[model samples]
Structures are given as C-alpha cells and as structure tokens.
Target: MLNSINTNPGALIALQNLNATNTELNTAQSRINTGKKVANAKDNGAIWSMAKMQSASSSSLNAVKDSLQRGQSTIDVALAAGDTITDLLMKMKEKALAASDTSLNTASFNALKSDFESLRKQITKAVDNAKFNGVGLVDKSAKALVFLANADGGSFTVNAQTLSLEGLNLTTALASFSTVAEAGSMIGKMTAALLTATNKLSALGTASTGLDTHLTFIGKLQDSLDAGVGNLVDADLAKESAKLQSLQTKQQLGVQALSIANQSPQSILSLFKG
Candidate 1:
C-alpha cells in the first residue's frame, strides 16, 4: 500500500473500522440500559410491531377483568339479599300458621298478624336495598346487568329477578289474616315467594360462577400475551453485557490502529529529510 501524506488509505480504513465498532458499542449499551432488544421500530421493525400489538391486547383484557369484578360484586349483593328475604319468608310463614289456629283470641291473632306484617315488610326492604353500583337486581324496575366479556365489545347479561312486595304478593294491604282461610292462603303465598327467591338466588349464583371462570381465563390469557411480547422484545441482559464489554475493547483497538496508520504518513517525511 502507498503511504502518501495527502491521502492515507490505511488511516481511512482504520477510521471506518473504528466508526463501525463505535456504532456496535452504542447499540449494546442501549440494550443494556433499556433491557429491550426492540425498543423501537428501528431496532427490529417486524418484532417491535408484533410486541406492541400483543401488549395492546393484554391491556384490553385487563379492562375486561375489571368489568368482570364489578359484575361479581353486583351478583354477590343480590345473592345476599335473596338469602335474607328467604329467611324472612320462613318467619312470616310461621306467624301466619300460628294465626290460623281457631283457639287464638282476637288479641293474639292481631299480635301474630302484626308480626307477620313486620316480617313481610322487612323482605320488601331487603329487596329494595339489594343494589350494587346503583343497580338493583331484585327490585320492581330491575334490569339485566351487562358486562363486557372481551375487548371486542362482546358481552354477557345477568337476568334480573323481581322480589318486591307486589312481586311476592306480600304487600301491606294483602298481609292481613282476619280468618283461618285467609291465614292458610297467606301461608301458600309465602311458600311460593320463598321458592321464587331461592330460584333467583340459584340463577345469580350461577352467573357469578361464570364470571369468575371468565376472569380466570382472562388472567391466563393476559399472562400468555405478556410472555409472548417479552419473548419478542425483551433483551437478554447477560448477553448484552458481554457484548458491550467486547465492543468496548474492539473500539479501543480500532482507535489505536487508526493512530498507528496516521503516524505511517509521518514516516514518509523521514525519507525526504535524509
């Protein structure tokens, strides 16, 4: 190779190698700092795009999980109210049966009627208050609760059940037991109301169970998506660290080689001085 003072090819080649080494060292250092192999589209365009899409999917599933949890809470409140109403129905039925006996005096019959009315009123209150997030599933104007099942606007609905006073035929006006016949009829109505409440409870329980199962599936799906994204974009810190050290060493050697190549042109001056 001709060592010329005006243009040193060896120095130019050494400088080019040094620049390439510096570029590689910077990339390894960036991976180490960010802990991601594909931090941006420029790093690995296809892999970065895929990872971003999966991450967005995981976020959408997280919203679904939130909806499921809220739905569970609503169902839980309704179930609890149904249980209390069932208990109140049993007590009201007992009062009605005691009032049906012919031996009971007027005062005793009225006392039993009063207790029955109180218990029936309590059932109405229970149904009225069986609400969560401003939604009552066991009320006169109850509506089905809808929850998102996925990010794509898919949904599940929980049917509402009315357990109000008029719904159970245990309203204040109809709760009187003036005769044995009336008391017996009241007992039958109470039995039917109890059955209705229990059936509603069963349905709500099933819905809650379904929500729980969906939530579990969503959790697993999010985990799988996250793992996939990580696989596509996450950097191997150990490997990057090793690469950074090697590149640093190579960069130092490149600079030294360039320096030596530049000095070669000065050696040409010695030929003319003699």
Candidate 2:
C-alpha cells in the first residue's frame, strides 16, 4: 500500500479491534464480580423474569411457615394445660372416695370436702390459663385456629377443644362432698370428666402432628424453588475466570498492535528525509 501522510488505514483497523477486545473484557469482569450471568433483564430477559417470580414465591412461603409455627405452639400450650387438669381430676376423685366411707366423723368429713373443693378450683385455673398469643384453645374462647399453608391462599385449621368446668358439665355448685350420697355422685362425675379431657388431649396432639408434617414439606418446597432460581441466573465462576484471563491477555496484545500501527506513519518521515 502507498504511504499517506494524512491517514493510516492500519491504525483505524487496529483501533476497531482494540475497542472490540475492551468490550469483551468488561463483560467478563462483570460476570466474575456479580457471580450471575443474568443479573438483570439486559443479560437474559426471559431467564431473569422467571427467576424473580420463583424468588417471590419462596419469600412468601417463609411467611406461611411462620404462621404454621405459631399455630403449633398454641396447640402445645393447650395440651400442657390439659395434662395438668387430668392429674387434678384423679386427685379430686381420691378425695371424694374417702369422704363417701359413710362412717367418717363430722370433722374428718368436712376436711375431705374442703380438699375436694380446693382441687376443683385448680381445674378452673388451669383451663383459664391455657393460652398462647392471647388465644385460649381449651377454654371455649376460640372456636378454631387457622394457619396459612401455602402462597396460594391454602390453610390448615385446628379446632378448639373446650375443657373448662362448664364445658365438662361439672359445675361448681354440684361439687358437694358434705354427705355420703353427694360424695358418691362426685366420684361418678370425676370419671366422666377424665374421659372427656383425655379425648381433647388426643385431638390437640393429632393437630400438632399434622402441623409438624406440613412444616417439613414447606421447607423442602422452598429449597427446591431457591435451587431453581440459582440454576437460571447463577454464573459458572470457573468458566468466567478462565475467560477473564484470556480477555486480559488479548486486550494487552490489542494495545500493542495499535501502538505498532500508530508508528507506521513515522516510517514515511524516512522516505522524505534530507
């Protein structure tokens, strides 16, 4: 080619090649720094949009898990109180049996009656206090507790088990151990109350077990969604590192080639030298 003083074709070609290399180098660095090939819509619009949707679902499930856990805890508190009331029933039954001997003196009979009354009051106290997060499941206060099971508006309900003195038909006024016949009547009531309380405890226990099983499933579902999002967007760091090194070497070579092209015009000075 003829040497020209005004323009150098080689320099223009070299500059174009160098600009191309710089663009590739910037992309490699970005993948390495962010660790995601499709961090935004510009990278891969379809994949980015899908990943965002799945991430939102996983986040919503976290709230669902929290609600289920609270429901489980409420049932646990009620179960604990139910067990305490059952034990108190057995003790009250023993007090009534002793008072029904039909041969006890007035002093002994009155003492036994007082003990039975004290134990009866304890059952009421236990029922009133079986609360969690301001909800009493076993005291006839709440009909049921419903917890979120999924992001799609599904739910699980734990029905209340009313185990109070009024619920068990063992009213405070009927608890009279002053006479042998009255003490015998109380013994029969204690047996029926024990049966009712045991059944309620079983129901609460079954609901608790169901909640635990569902929580395990929710955890697994969240993990699967997270993994799917990672598959769609996460970059291969090993591949990006190798690409970065190759691009850095090519960029350095491009700069050297541009410098050589710029010097080509200087050789024309020798052609016109004195």
Candidate 3:
C-alpha cells in the first residue's frame, strides 16, 4: 500500500532537508562556542571515557603532589632546626672547654657549666617543638624522617627512622665539676652526643635531597598531564580557525539552499495563477 506521507513528497522532502541542515548548523555553532568537538560523553562515548580515565589519573597524581609538598616542608623545617642544634652543640663544646681552664675555680667553672646546661635544654626544646602541621619530625612522635609516595596515590612506607636524642641524658653536665678530669669527662660525653647528631643530620639531609628530586619529577609529571589534557580538550586554534571559515561559508550556502527549497512550493501557487 502507498504510504500517506508519500502523497505529498515535495513537502516531506523539503521538511527532511531542513531538519538535516538545521542539525549541521547547530553542531557547527556548538563547536564554535565551546571550542570542543566532544562537549560531553554523548558526543563520542569511547573517546570521552578515555578522557575521563586520563582525568582520573591526573587527579590521583595531583593528590600525591599535595602530600609530597607537605612532606618536603616538614623535612625543610626539621633540617633547619637540625642545623641550629648542630651550631648550639658546637657552642656548648666551647663552653665545656672553657670550664676546664686551670685558672677557673669551682665557682667560675660552675657558671660556665650553667650556660652549657641551658644550651642543652634549648636543644631539647627545639627538637620537642619542631613541628609541621602539628606533627613532630624530631621528637618521639614520628618514627621516620622521610616519607615517600607510591604510584597508586597511597604512601609507600620507606625506612626513614630518625635517631632519637632523648636518651642522651645531660643532667650531670649542669652540676659543678671540681676537677679538670670531671670537666673533661663531661666534654667527652657532650662530644659523643654532638657526633651522633651530626651523623643523623647527614642521613636526614640525604633523604631530603631524594625527596627534592622526587618533587621535581612530580612537577614534570603534572606539566605533562596538563599538556595531555590540553591536547584532548583544547581546540587547535589554527585548525579551528580554518574550520570556522568553512562553517561560515557552508552556513551561508545552507541558508541559500533552504531559501531555494522553500521556493519550490511557491511554484504550485504560480501554476494556479497561470
């Protein structure tokens, strides 16, 4: 049986052509405004899915970067405080040697000992107070000195154990040492503690250097990810410019074609007039 719509082929064909042309015109307009061919997942499901995957990876990396930054800052604070403590210990040694002077009596030596003792307390205070975001780096709080991040956005536990200076009890260093031998013994103990601090600081410094290198790599990764995202989403200005020109011309021509198509129906009116 002949379809009822086929009875008026001219009107049906004209309407169909108009709808198709209108769709193309709208697509071109959308691309022009958004500067993206795939504005949403519906544009191309597979390609959009891949872009989302890449986006998810980038997000994970970004989170890692934040933690790495915080770790680096914590190390930096610890490093600075370690340096000051190293200097303080050296000064304390100078005072210890001054106490051993033959001319200095028990009372004079006691004054020097008091100053050295005060410096030791200051060193302990510095360590106890060394904190980044309320997490102590040098105190008994943290077991490790360095933190490393893994690829899956989870932190990989690296052995960064810091040496605890808590056990170096220096209470006796405060009391007056009468004999030169007593002062010398105190100096010896203090020197050993200083050496230990130096060694630990060296280890911490090495770990911090490694973290700095990792941070640099992460920064590069972020840059690469940003460039990749741009490649996927950003319109190539040169290509889009050319496309814009072509679409403009095609739109003008499409309007003209539609105008001409509409005129085909007017021919029936002309026939009646004749």
Predicted candidate 1 versus true structure: per-residue lDDT over 46-121, tens digit per residue: 9999999889999999889999999889888988998898898899889999988889899999999889888887
Name the candidate, 1 or 3, with the larger lDDT value.
Answer: 1
Tens-place lDDT per residue, model 2, 1-274, is: 9699689999899999999999988888898999998989999999999999999999999999999999988998999999899998899999999999889999998999899989889988998888988887999566888899999989899999988887776777776556988998889989998998898889999999999999999999999999999999998999999999998999999999999999998998897789
lDDT string for model 3 (1-274, tens) is: 2324225554556566667766766766677688777778888787667777777777777777777788877777777778878887788878878888879877888888788777877877878777788765666556653354645745533233243356344444343355667777668867876787777778777777877788788778767876776677655656666766776676676666666655665555655674
TM-score on alpha carbons, each prediction: 0.93, 0.89, 0.81
Q: In what order do the candidates fall by lDDT, top score first?
A: 2, 1, 3
| lDDT assessment of candidate 3 | 0.68
Q: How displaced is residue 208 in candidate 3, in Å?
A: 1.5
Model 1, 264: alpha-carbon shift in Å?
Answer: 1.5
Q: Which of the two candidates, 1 or 2, achieves a greater lDDT against the reference?
A: 2
Ranking by TM-score: 1, 2, 3
Q: State the displacement of the C-alpha of residue 56, model 1, in Å, after optimal TM-score superposition.
A: 1.9
Q: What is the lDDT of residue 13 in candidate 2?
A: 92
What TM-score should be assigned to candidate 2?
0.89
Candidate 3: list runs displaced more than 4 Å.
1-21, 145-151, 156-178, 261-274
Query: Over all chains combined, what TM-score does candidate 1 have?
Result: 0.93
Please say which candidate is ahead in TM-score: 2 or 3: 2
